[model samples]
Target: MSEPLPWYKHFWPWFIVVLLLGVIIKSLVALNIAIDNADSLVSDDYYKEGKAINMDLRKIKQAKNLGMQFLVKVEEHQLIITQHGGPQYKAALQVSFIHPTLEDKDFNVNATADGTGAYRIALSNAITGPWNVRLEGFDNSWRIQQRVVINDDVEYWLN
Candidate 1:
């Protein structure tokens, strides 16, 4: 009769042990990654935001009642805005570029319309990625919002 091999010297036993250890190590690594990269997609004041939805809807309705239409385009580092079928006013419009996840990257500019209905603003840097664009009249009587993913030069129309 032959003597049995020790557990450490057995190929089948060591192979099973190594396989289990590998799975454990991989799970630990995945857990570390998940802990380090916490999601920040939720706002801290989500309740307040929910409460303000009605006000935002009212603003949107005001814009619709005024028959507001706009054409937004970028050209040579400048933002061009053309208004159509909107009430004429001599006030600078407020244009806000809100980053989806980063508040520090948000920017705002006041665009004054030319003698015609066209407005222009010079951009010091290029804008890319996803942005929530909010355009409001100087009097705050009307507002329009749009979500745009800017990959390259493109045109956006709001009505």
Candidate 2:
């Protein structure tokens, strides 16, 4: 009777299989290392630190642009005021807008937060020119004054 082939003697098949597996594993490891190193280069702590250092970056960079998710967008031909913050500010929302030209007269509107740190106020009548929108938070005692201009035309949309 012919002797059966031993497991160790299956050189070509085993070598090919092991080589393919090794290549795949090496590629996976390289990818994982690259991802890990990239993540480490810009860690969450570093991001948080950057934001902390520049307080107005988030407000200006995110809020200044239209179609921001969290920032409120004022409609065209209409003036809108919004207040946004955290849980402690649930009780009250006060926003006041005043045109620099009209110093004594200011449009004041009280906004209601929908328990999501976002509040919106719409002016019934349209107002124009350069204005200042001041937002005051009840809980954290935070205040943010944003300058905005309302043009007579062009509808505003938040995406």
Candidate 3:
């Protein structure tokens, strides 16, 4: 009869050990990645931000009262914005493209209205994924917000 094999030489034990080690290594890698890529979306001054909600609400109310609406279209690298009904002639409009994840990717473009209610601004760079667009009068009297998922080109209306 052959002598009994040592536990280390057993196939089942070694297989179990290897499987456990692989799981442990994978878990460690995932934990390291989560720690390294910490993306915090909350502002440092959250209290002040919370207090400012009332002001934003007032601006939104003003926009509603003024019957403000916008038609935004993105083509190539140009952003065309048409005011459906608002101030007859706005000197300047503040358009902000806010990236949901990366703050550094967020950018603001100031557009001047033509004689008509149409405004056009050239975008220096193209953006991908989801973005929160905020449009407000330069004086902050009225504001409109819209969320868009931009793949190639998009057009939408904000009311």
- lDDT for 134 in candidate 1 is 90
- The ten-residue window of minimal lDDT in model 3 covers 83-92
Q: List the residue pairs that clash in candidate 2.
A: none
lDDT at position 79, candidate 1: 85
Which pairs, if any, clash in model 1? none
RMSD of each: 3.8, 17.2, 3.8
lDDT of 2 at 21: 100
Per-residue lDDT value at 139 in model 1: 80
Which whole-number lDDT from 0 to 100 does residue 128 have in model 1?
A: 81
- lDDT string, candidate 1, 38-153, tens digits: 77676799989988887888888999998888888876588888886667656899999999988778899988988876888888878888999999888887889989886546
What is the model-wide C-alpha lDDT for candidate 2? 0.58
TM-score per model over all chains:
0.68, 0.41, 0.72
In lDDT terms, how accurate is model 1?
0.85
lDDT of 3 by residue, 15-97 (tens): 99999999999999999999988877868999999889989889989988888989888888888899887656466889999
Residue 77 of model 3 has an lDDT of 82
